[model samples]
Target chain A: MAEAVAGCVRHGLPAIGLWRQNVAEQGLDETVRLVKDAGLRVSSLCRGGFLTAPDFEADNRRAIDEAAALEAACLVMVVGGLPGVVPGEPLGEISRDLPAARERVAEALALLAPYAAERGVRLALEPLHPVYCADRAVLSTLGQALDLAAPYAPETVGVVIDTFHVWWDPQVFEQIGRAGREGRIASYQVCDFLSPLPDVLLGRGMMGDGVIDFGPLTGAVAAAGYAGDVEVEIFNADVWAADPDEVVATMKNRFERLVVTRV
Target chain B: MAEAVAGCVRHGLPAIGLWRQNVAEQGLDETVRLVKDAGLRVSSLCRGGFLTAPDFEADNRRAIDEAAALEAACLVMVVGGLPGVVPGEPLGEISRDLPAARERVAEALALLAPYAAERGVRLALEPLHPVYCADRAVLSTLGQALDLAAPYAPETVGVVIDTFHVWWDPQVFEQIGRAGREGRIASYQVCDFLSPLPDVLLGRGMMGDGVIDFGPLTGAVAAAGYAGDVEVEIFNADVWAADPDEVVATMKNRFERLVVTRV
Candidate 1:
């Protein structure tokens, strides 16, 4: 947690997305203190889902409490997949009832939304890639995310646009525009991939190295009037093993070279 | 070449997509004779284009001749990329002038179309996945393919829908429907992938093993009124290394179980 915060501070990155494990490891209070000291914004708390289980009430409330403790701007929910004792596995394998699972997610979000709003934390619904549809998020498209957020006030519910997950989407620009117009574009992440990829979760490229035309993509988002900080989130093992300072410097350089120049 | 044709015959698959090298190895006359003997339809010949180059007229003409000789229903084109020659490579890198390349493709197709029509072969415009956008087909979507085919008649030009390249698209159904309605849906290929995949070419899955809902997809194509063969074109090394008979049997079973049930 300290390392992440320090990296964000040294890199002059305005904000950072935090994983729940990092917070738990440092103790939420210490993590929050470090973030405050660094004067960095919490773009979002890493995640707060896996809510499809039978005992979602307890898990959802705990996520809310953690987000509150961290004073996060939004509790980014990686909504759980299925309902069962083993909480993290996808819900589809055992249950054929997708509509019911979706309803369960909505209910969990509903329960957490008011608390998050009370605590001044927005609820950001991230539509994961379709690969995770069965076990991670049933909400697999930006259109679907907007549809999910349609019933809620923009301040209460919004969407996270992770480039790695959404770059392949033909409707990305249209959806980003819709989100901006509707005031539901909560956060934007930037990452790249050379597809027909394997182990998709970890094989993301470092910006320009992949085929994604980030220039046009970031431009489209900004054109849609999104003013949020661009979060550089790469899950590649290659990047993770590199010197942290070098990685941060490279990202800063790429951000200016690729994103700022285009937008 | 003989092995591939024999495997197709033994497996009872209605059609087989043949690569150009395999066709060349068997000699065009023998290849045609073998395919005829086996009583299998030649779904689509695996190539015809690298036309982004300055000296592609001869190669393009040869490809057309080869397609005619092989008796392929459709000559599937994987259009070439950038203009410069890469070191240690025979062909040059992709050109940045996408519009010029598109025009080149159009010109080549126009010249070959009449000849192809005479030989009773169709020109199938296969819009490759975006990852190949730099060096492969700039026609990366069905919409793009249709747009390219707009000036040509359906009898002269059509689009090939390879599910592996297109299933990630949210607009696939809409585009497939549009293609069918416009009479541009010429060939349909089925293969699956678990996204965040590696080796974009060889990572393809057998039907029903990956994320694509084959039943729904094929059903949509059929509903759009396409009475074409569902070619199971898998490129997985796992499946490729297995006994050829086993692979065919598996595909046959999957076609009946998943595809037939849906259609």
Candidate 2:
């Protein structure tokens, strides 16, 4: 965690998106202090939405607190997939399918929304790709996530525009426009989509490494009036194996070429 | 092919979905005669898409003729994904991506729709799961397929409702209802969707084994007025390696309890 923060500073990056596990490893208070003292901003906290967990409210409360401590823009939420071992739910013995899981997410969000708002921490619902609907997240599109956040205040409930996941969606650009109009574009994540992937979860390619034509996508988002930190979140094995400095350099280059210049 | 047809006869199964390759290997004439002699019906021919191929028109014409020769119900179409490596076309030199591939599919369908209409072979557009949108079929939803089939007569161009492929779609039930109202349902294929899929293509599970709650999905199709052979197309390695008799038995058993009885 320290290495990452120092590396960001060294690379002249604006902010750091910290995962909860990494934050917990370094102790929340110390991590918060370290990031703040170094003048780094938390773009967005990694996550907090496995609503299938038995103690979802309790867990998410802590996640909100952590995001608050780090002063994150919003706590990104990956709503749990089918009624099963939700990422945050160790005691998750849920029996719901897609529709049921979706209902549960609304219920879970209702329970957390007020709390997040009270803490001045926004809840950013992220829609993973439909491929992960069976196991990773029931939320599979930006429109659906926006619908889920409809009843709440835009500041209290927002939607993430993760290019890796939403790049394939036909409704994405329109939804981004809606999010921007509604003041719900919490975070914009960039990553390319690759296929013939051996393991689906780890298949996210670096920006510009795969088939995604990010220029139009970014242009659409920009047209929607979104001016926010765009985080590069690649999960490929090859990308992770490269030197941190190299990966950072490549990401910035791709971000400029594929997104900044076009948008 | 003969063994499968004979087995279907012994088991009192009315029809067998035939793959074109299998028919070609057994000699089209002999295979057609064998099924006809055994009083077995061809539910639907496995495919005839890859529209990006250079010789797509000629190839599809042959497929249409083959389906007519076998008296198959429809020619199930797996519209080719991104342009390159389409089935024919000399290892395929096409460079079109998703949108281009989709446009090519419509163009190819426009050309073949007349040919198919003249021959009495319905073209069944099977929208593969979105996960396959980049590599297998650009048509990733029943709605998309229906839209593509909009300009044609329902009898000439119809959409397939494959439970395994579309079970996760948020718009699925509504789309199935639409297809039925439009009388555009060409085939009803069933297989369960399993996640953490080792091989994306081979991840389709036998009906009841996966997380998919097939009851509602099948019910919607049935409620939409589809009364056709529900072909079970599983590409799982284990199921493929299992004894044919066992595989058939399991599929029938699951189909009854998880689908027939429920829907």
Clash-forming residue pairs, model 2: none
Give lDDT tens digits, candidate 2, residues A1-263.
Answer: 99999999999998988899999999999999989988998999988988865668888999999999899998999988877644323323445367888898999999999999999999999999888886778898888898999999999999999887886666677788898899999998888777555467887887755656677778878888878888888888888889999999988888887767452
Query: For model 1, how does the per-residue alpha-carbon lDDT over A21-72 read when each residue is reduced to its tens digit?
Result: 8888899889889998899887788787776866767766777788777777
User: Which window of ten consecutive residues has the lowest lDDT sum in model 2 chain B?
Assistant: B85-94
Model 2: residue B149 alpha-carbon error in angstroms: 1.3
TM per candidate: 0.83, 0.95
All DockQ scores? 0.17, 0.40
Task: Give the docking tier of candidate 1.
Answer: incorrect
Kindly report which residue stretches of model 2 are placed more than 4 angstroms away from their true locations once superposed: A86-96, B85-97
Candidate 2 docking category? acceptable
In Å, residue B61's CA in model 1 sits off its true spot by 4.1
Question: Which one is best on lDDT?
Answer: 2
Q: Evaluated with DockQ, which candidate comes out highest?
A: 2
lDDT of 1: 0.73
